[model samples]
Structures are given as C-alpha cells and as structure tokens.
Target: MKISAELRAFSGRLGHDFARPELLQRALTHGSIASTTRPDNQRLEFLGDRVLGLTMAEALFSADRAASEGQLAPRYNALVKGETCAAVAREIGLGDVLKLGRSEMLSGGRRKEALLADALEAVIAAIYLDAGLEAARGVILKHWADRLKNVDSDSRDAKTVLQEWAQANGMTPPRYVQTARSGPDHAPEFEITVRLDDGREAIASGQGTKRSIEQAAAQALLDRIEGTT
Candidate 1:
C-alpha cells in the first residue's frame, strides 16, 4: 500500500519507517472510528505503556548510578505519565494526523490530551512491532532527551510532594476541591482549590480533565509554599 505524504512525514518525525505500514495506520486509528476492518489503538496503547515504562526505567537506572530506587521511581513516573506523553505527541505533530470519527473531530479530539497521549503510545508500540526494542528505545530517548536530562526538576509530582510534606509536618493529607467547571461538554476548564489542614491553600485553573486540573492546583499550592514559582 502506498503511504500518504502526511503519514510519510509523520514517520520521518517519528524517526522510524515502518516495514509494515498497516501498523502505523492502526496506531493512528481511534476507537471513535474503529470497525471490524479498522482496529483501534487501544491494544497498542496498552503494550506501548509497558514499553515506555521499561525504556524509561532502564534509562533512568543507567543515567543515575548514585540515585537510589526512591529517587529513580518518581523520575520514571514523571517521564512516563500521560501528560508527558501528550507533550511529546504535540512536539511531533501527532495530533494533526490522527484518524478521528466525526464526533471526535467536532469535539476537538485532535487536541485532547488523553487522545494524543494514547495515540503516541500506540505509535510507540507500532514502531516496536515494526522494528524492535532498540528501535522503540531510540525513538523514546530521542523525543525525551531534554526531559531525561532535566528529570531532576520534575523528580516528584506536586501532589506527591505536597502529601509527603503534610505527613512529615503531622498534618492531614491535602484536599482538592473543584470550585467550578465551564465550557462546552467536549472541552472544559476546571477551577480547583488545594487546601492543607494547616490552612494553607491555593487555587488554580486548567483546561482538561478534573484529575489533571486538581493536580495542577496542588502543584500551584506546592509552588507557593516552596516559593519556587
């Protein structure tokens, strides 16, 4: 089958020319558009998640000999999280080539974080199937080079750090409350508040799922407390 110019360009950006182009096609297909003939990327996404985790884990272990498992765990999580994957997808323009159903297209599915992240994982799996583990690792490291180098900055998520701080200080866990949600059903902005038992609190707004917004709010509070941002 002749690959489209767009898919060809995407393959270039992805740094892997698929021997089996159908894998790439399947990876780009979304559940919204899936049929018996066109399989969605869900299974690929599942496999890619594990592939990504293993790649990151090995990279982190090799990069930091002095760092203990305690330190490496969080860095691995930061690198493999959905948000990070979505950011990488955006960098590669993965969203532009996504094959979405009509409803998804109308609902701004191309820009959705979850969709972008999932597609990226599926693409990783596609590359793995087409090539090998080394190929998959090379692609992941190429895209995540900067993040891996600066992994110290994001070693722990804001929520995790905040919880650790609270526990250390003998306070209860932080509470996250969604104050408001606005926008169309397809896209929404969330206003969330993160409160500590000791009365310290912070409010922040983000565009995406409630969990992400809540995490952003917690991060905001942590930044304020730590005077980092």
Candidate 2:
C-alpha cells in the first residue's frame, strides 16, 4: 500500500524508511477518526510501550554497571514518561502528520500531550513490526539521544519530590486544584494551584494533560518553598 508524501518525509525525520508503509499509516491514525476500515494505533501503542521499556532498560543497564535497581528505576521512568515521549514527538514533528478527526483537528488534537505520546509509541511499534527490535531501538535512541545521555538520578518527577517534601515537614500533601480550563477540548490549558495545608500555594498553567501541568505546579511550589528555606 501507498503512503502520503507527508508521511514519507516524516519517515525521513523519524530516521526509519518503512518496509511496510501501512504500519506507519496506522501508527499516525487516532481513535477519534478510526473506523472498521482504518484501525487506530491503540494496539500498536501497547506493544510499543513494552518495546520502549525493554529498550530503555537495556540501555540504562548497559550504560551503568554500578547502578542499583532503585537508582535505575527513576531514570527509566524519566525516560519513558509521557512528557518525555511527547517532547521527542514534537522534535520529530509527529503531531504534524497525525490523522485526527474533524473535531480533534478543530480542538487541536495534534498538540495534545497524551495523543502525541501515544502516536509516537505506535510509530515505534510500527518500526518494530516492520523490521525488528534493533530497528526500534535505533529509532528510539536516536530520537532520545540527548535525553538518554543526560538522564540521571536527579531526573525524578517533580510531583513525587513535592509530595515527599510535604510529608517530611509533617504537613498534608499539596492539593492540586484546577482553577481554570481554557482553549479547545483536545488541547486545553489548565491552571492548577498547588496549595499546602498551611495555606501557602503556587499556581502554574500550561497546555497538556492535567497531570503534566500539575507537575509544573508542584515544581513551582517546590522552588518557592525551598528557596525561602
């Protein structure tokens, strides 16, 4: 089967020329616009998630022989998290070639964090299916080259650290309340206020999934509290 010129160029950007272009097509197709004839990338995403985990696990283990499982876990999470995947997706312009439905397009589905992340995983699965693990690993490492190189123990999620800080201080965990949601449905910007039981709070806003922006709020709050200490 034939793929579009746009996808063909995207193949170059992703550094994988498809032996089976249909897999690439399905990889970019979203559930919102899927049908009996054209399946979405959900299955591919599932497989790709595992593929990514295994690859990252191998890379991290091989890269550092002295690191413990506990040390490796956070770094692995840092690399495989949705935010990292979304960032890599943006770098390769995966969102630009997505096959979104009419409503999704209007709502800015292309830029949605979760959607972009899922599509990237599906594309990985496609590459794996087209060739093998080696191909998938090559693509992943190449796209995530800088991230993998720079990932360290300090790469732990900010949300986890913020909650830990609250517990350490004998205070209730920070509450993340969505104060305002604006923009279209698929790509809304959320304003989240992270408040401590003692009434200190920090507000932050960004476009993406609520959880991602909540991390931003948590980081902002952490910076504020820690800076004052």
Candidate 3:
C-alpha cells in the first residue's frame, strides 16, 4: 500500500518530515506479518528503544536537577514503558496507520498495546533515520513533555507502586494468579489475572521468562487500577 499521504500528514503533525517514508513503514510493521515479507520493525524497535531511553534520560536530567541516576532510572522507565508508548502511539493514530497481515489485522493487532508500543518505537527510529537524533528528540519532547512533568521521574517499579496503592487504600496485598499459561515450557507466555481485595481484577498477558511475566502482570495491574482511579 502507498503510505505517503498518511506518512506525510503524520510527519506534519509531528513537526517534521521524513525524506524516506519507507523507513517509517518498516518501523511500523509488526514482526507477525513483516518477518517474512520485509525487514520488519524489530531493528527499528531496537534502535528506537535506545533513542527513547536516551531522550527520556535527557528530559529527566533537564527537568530534575536534584535527581541521581538511581532516582531517574525508574522515572525514565515509567515514561518510556510499553503502556506509555502505546498511549502516545494511539494519540497520534499510529495504530490506524500500521500495516498488518490479514490474520493480525483480523485479530485486532491495531489495538494491542504491545504492538502499538513497538510501532511507536519503530516510528521514532524512522524519524531518527530520516532526519537526525535532534529531530526525534523534538518529537518525543513534544508528545511526552506533559507526562514527564507530572510523573515522578524517581518513582520505583510498578510492583512497588501497586503495592503502595493497595496499602494506601487499606486493601489486602494484590494477588497475581496465573489464569492461563501457553506456548512451550521453554518459551511460555503467561496470562496473569491480578485481583485486588476490593473485587477488582485486571488481567495482563506477557510472553517471557517467569520473572518477566510477574513484572509484566504487576505493571498491567498497576496501570488498570491507576486508570480507574
């Protein structure tokens, strides 16, 4: 599909233009479909992930002069986390612009937070490739400045945040239950259902080692409750 119109308009909204829109396309393409067809977005994702980290670190440094490296790490993680990235992607209609295979499209890949996050990172990499690091930093600063201002750049991990929220509300500690486990034992994808004593449950699905799944589940629960409150 010819994506120039969409790319051009998106670039304009981003306050920059891409000399090569194909890079943008490759950045937004998900591996599910693009693995066999094209280079896919993974490489861009790798590059964009670093770009996002560096951009966020710079923002934190400029905004919080008193913060130490330890203090800034978690804050940086929160801003550039998958959920935050997905939110930004949604804000700019990245999901709609994404090119998916028939199967992925039918499966609602456009709405998946992980896919949205990955695509956003790819787009960042694309912008970086098209223009320069400064251009990409401008885009990040434009979209994410507000979040950077509001969230504590020195906050702890999501699990800690979730626990604190539960404690503050006088509720029992949050429980993470393994609702479904799929894929091979060597490479399992866990579907965790996090429940609060207050009769609320938020499910998070993640593919990883056991430890990572636990963290993903906790992060999912934290986001769900945070959104509600």
Q: Tell me how far candidate 2 lies from the true structure as C-alpha RMSD in angstroms.
A: 2.5
Candidate 3 on 28-126: residue-level lDDT in tens? Answer: 777767766577898899899999999998888998899888888788878988878988888888888887989788767787777889888988998
Give the TM-scores of the predictions, in the order they appear: 0.87, 0.86, 0.71
Residue-level lDDT of model 1, residues 46-164, one tens digit each, is: 99999999999999999989999899988998899889999999999999999999999999999999999999999999999999999999999999999999998866677888899
Among all windows of 10 consecutive residues in model 1, the one with the lowest summed lDDT is 220-229
Best-matching candidate per TM-score: 1
lDDT of 3 at 210: 51
Give model 1 RMSD, 1 decimal.
2.5
Clashes of each: 0, 0, 0
* Candidate 1 backbone collisions, by pair: none
lDDT of 2 by residue, 127-190 (tens): 9999999999999999878888889733867888988988998988889999999986656789
State candidate 3's TM-score: 0.71
Model 1 has an lDDT value of: 0.92
Candidates by lDDT, descending order: 1, 2, 3
Candidate closer to the true structure by lDDT (higher is better), 1 or 3: 1
